[model samples]
Target: MKSETYKITNAVVEDIITETSNIKTFVLKPDKGLEFKTGQFVELAVKGLGEAPFTPSSDPGISEKIDMTIMKVGLVTDAMHNMKKGEILGIRGPYGQGYPIDDFKGKRVCVIGGGVGLAPLRSLLYELMHDLSRFEKVSLYYGAKTPKDIVYKNYVKKLQQEKELDLFLTVDQADDSWTGNVGVVTTILEDLNPENSIACVCGPPIMMKFSTLKLLEIGFKEEDIYLSMEKNMSCGVGKCGHCRIGNYYACKDGPVFTYAQIKNFDEIWD
Candidate 1:
């Protein structure tokens, strides 16, 4: 992979779409086009502060700007919350091979996303939802900490309206006012048939680990199960040693990878 660093001459904080308290969507435009794939991530830098790898939550085709729905969970991201509109930042490429959309053609695709991990998967969902005919069935299972924690609330609602697509939502624990499925994300996976379909999993380490296990038990092939490995990725171009999970570089080799690719790696979640 080559280095593709660009300055964010134009940046803006878009609407706080979901009232997920700690999570919000930021819409940013580059000085020039910063094209990338759905599963690939970019290195977001706040000058003199720090940088972190974040997946673009916008459609892969829309090169004008990118939307990153981030959760304020760490140092750099917390600093990001303090940033105002028009503040310039640093960004880089749409690296890595995304989901095998081509292979999924004419086949049902199942997407399971948990918490902030839903951001990257939303990019793929955006693209897939646009052209529903290209796919057989698009079933999405998204889980969050609570009902209010769900991101992309409007989009998920619209997806539910599409008869061709089935959207399953669950909350770990809900308030007295909320009524919906209550359990782990893996529990929702049981409601679907993994046979002859592609399964994509992204979430907190524990959620994804168990989700993968459940998918395999439901008959999804190991190679057919795609996982977006969440790790500390510094240099999005692979130079930084922060995202290394053995010989593999999460920034370069993944952020998105098949289970067959990294299942044997030691302490992958560590």
Candidate 2:
């Protein structure tokens, strides 16, 4: 029999890392170990403030503790940001389907993330890095509103030096300290070869839409491009229709799906 899906497990905030001005990464130690595939998300609940779905930003290989990188976007997340270490919270799920990393073996993989959307892609990145030989090439294209908004700043800098990975960074607007690429994330796509490659993308709806178009223009097949469709995912299960996109439920069927799987869905870009 399948395990209970609605049970909420208790977890304690172990540590917190500030990623950007408005984003923070919370380290939580669950009462019991939790193992989840990269790209899967969990519904994190603050006692009286309610809950919201967030993807784990830490390595999926480690279950002792999980990291959730969250932005203070709304009431639930605002409470999460203000939550102190040792405070208690509830966790449910590792919900929705994750990226098909296994299918990416022997092929080139390209990941593109904008702003906090990088949270889920970060998990997938670490999973792919764990098995470096599985793919011919691994490239990450990341963008933020400004240099200060970049998440995992130090780590992203380190990734640029790794011979096995190709890392590209961009900002919508440049600051005095910013000297790197200045443009949208999709601007870097011109340098990427879509041949024998699959792309995994997540970001604001506008960014995802343009990135998908760029990938297609450069030859990425619709079926090979995976998208994270995280809308109003209140319930991690499909019982609630809050996250519905056409016939599919973003929570149950996917928060991760190929462009082809949802291309026909009206208002997918919304």
Residue-level lDDT for 180 in candidate 2:
95
Clashing pairs in 2: none
| Stretches > 4 Å off in candidate 1 | 1-18
Off by over 4 Å in 2: 1-5
Tens digits of per-residue lDDT for model 2 on 1-270?
548867789999999999998999999999988899988889999997788899899899998799999999899998898889999989988888888888999999999999999998988999999988999999999999999999998889889889999989999999999989999999988988878999999998999999999999988999999999878888788987899988899988899999999999889988
For all candidates, what are the clash counts?
0, 0
Reference-based TM-score, model 2: 0.97
Q: Give all TM-scores, in the order shown.
A: 0.92, 0.97
Top lDDT prediction, candidate number: 2
Give one digit per residue, the lDDT tens place, for model 1 in 86-182.
7776776666567768888887899999999899999988888778788888889999999888888887778779788888989999889677899
